[model samples]
Target: MRKILVVEDEDAIREVVALNLRLAGYEVTEAASAEQALAVFSPSAGFDVAVLDIMLPGMNGFSLCETIRRDSASIGIIMLSAKTLETDKIKGLSIGADDYMTKPFSVSELLARVEALVRRVGRQGASSAAPEPDGRMVSGVFVLDQKSRVLYKNGTPIDLTQVEFQIMELFFANPGVALVREKILEGVWGENYFGDVKIVDVNIRRLRMKIEDEPSAPKHILTVWGYGYRWNA
Candidate 1:
């Protein structure tokens, strides 16, 4: 069974989510605050995913997400928030979250999102263990090592969140192809994602900050006006 850490301040929300996750066959660990969650979390805990609420009693979700990410690169993170603003969503993704869900969300949809993230983590773990036939993809000064899930620019490592890495992989896989916003959402976030397509836009901006010498004048990942984005190289 996949282990999941759920951190929510509200007792009711925590109980409901934990109960449902257990029903769905996940080994659920619940915490009422970030401190409590951190107390029990360790590399050996073997958690596959973390579900964090943005509004917490202390040490807000974003900070907690960063802490968890600092501990484990392969574990998936999903942020829950009552905020509907695009900036808030972007902030969550910008930090390290693989996925974000606004409050008043359907439990079914949340479950699906969790499952998708778990599957993605599993796939990446497997890929890391297996050697790729085509080991590396090079575009301009950027190099993506598919087997290790690492990106390099000018032979130097570039830090990228899991979500950003996946987006980059998609662009590298289909160079010169214009990938629509919806296509990016489906590819990176999953087909069951019910969030805004703007998530793609946010991630694209983040990618530019890392890959482009000047984010305002991105040469590699270009906008296609009405269509979407295309990888020039």
Candidate 2:
């Protein structure tokens, strides 16, 4: 059974969420605080998804979500909160929360959201019945294999998280063109309604650390002044 970690401060809500997840045939773990959630959702974590509540006591769900994202990429994250403002939703999704739900939500709806996220993650891989074709695009020593989600520099594999892979895909698809921060977010994050552009900077820094010889003087992925970023292709 796939495991799910539920992080909610309210006892009643936490128990109810746990009960529903368990009923859905998942091994459920409960954490009432951000500190506890971190202890449970590390890189060597057991859970497959995290159902996190946004209104926690100390660290709050947003901070916890960022912490978890920094640790692992395979796990799904769904943020639950009573805050229905668009900004709140944007904040949650911008930091790598997979799905956001407003409070007073139905158990069935949450279950469906979880299922959808898991299914979407699975589809990123090429199926045996419909294998992805081989193609390569090279920029100096760095090479990208789109079908297999692999990046190689001089024949050695470069480790990229799923988000990084998507960013590279965007750059490859639109070579030599400036991709605005919002456009990259929409294409890569599945929703760019959020206003913050710093997330783009953070991911680009990560990509450079892996692919560029001198990140400060990037050759392939270049920054366009007052605009966005571009790939030399």
Candidate 3:
């Protein structure tokens, strides 16, 4: 069974989320505060996913999510927020949120997202090699190792969130090819997404920070003005 950690301040929403997740066959763990949530989370705790509320009594979900990312990128995180603004979603993605959902969302959609996140993580875990075009891809001194799901810069390992890894892999697959916003959305995330696409920009920018030698003037991943992003081989 997949273990899920739910951190929400509201009692009712937290209970509902936990109940629904349990019904879906997930082992659910709940936390009302960010501190408590972190206190409970460990690298070997065996949690497959984390469903976090953006708002909390202390430290907030964004910080909590970042902390978790710093520890492990293998685990999935879905940020839940009542704030529906594009900036809010961007912020969540910038800090390593794998998926974003606004408040008052359908339970079905939420469940689907949770399942998708889990499945995506599972695929990454199962793949002994990078799932990209023509074996593995490399640029400069950086190498994207498919089998291990690791990025090495100058022979040193680089830590990347799951979303960042996917973006990098996408770029590696289509080097120098301009990928449109819709294509990226459909590729990285599944279909039927009605949320803001600006989150893609946010995530791409964040991904650049890690993979690019200079984020200000990116060399590998370049934004194609009005088109989209291109990976320069």
What does candidate 1's lDDT look like per residue over 1-233, in tens digits?
99999999989888999999999999999999899999999878999999999999889999999898887867889999999998888899887787899888888888998998887777652322233467777777888887677899989998676677778888877889999999988887778776778778888988898888899999999999998999986
Return the TM-score for candidate 1, rounded to 2 decimals: 0.89
lDDT of 1 at 32: 91
* Model 3 error, position 195 (Å): 3.7
Clash count, predicted structure 1: 0
Give the CA lDDT, 0 to 100, for residue 66 in model 3.
92
Query: Which regions in candidate 2 have their CA more than 4 angstroms from the true location?
Result: 127-142, 145-233
Q: Give one digit per residue, the lDDT tens place, for model 2 in 18-62.
A: 998888888999999999988767777656788999989999999
Cα RMSD for candidates in order: 2.8, 5.8, 2.8
- Cα lDDT tens digits, model 3, 91-208, are 8888888889988888888888888778767766333234457445576577777667788888888877666777777777777789998787766665665556776888889878
TM-score computed on alpha carbons, candidate 3: 0.89
**TM-score for each predicted model, relative to the true structure:** 0.89, 0.63, 0.89
Estimate the lDDT of model 3.
Answer: 0.82
Query: Considering every candidate listed, which one attains the maximal lDDT?
Result: 1
Clashing residue pairs found in predicted model 2: none
Error of 1 at 22 (Å): 1.1
Evaluated at residue 108, the lDDT of candidate 1 is 88
The lDDT, on a scale of 0 to 1, for candidate 1 is 0.85
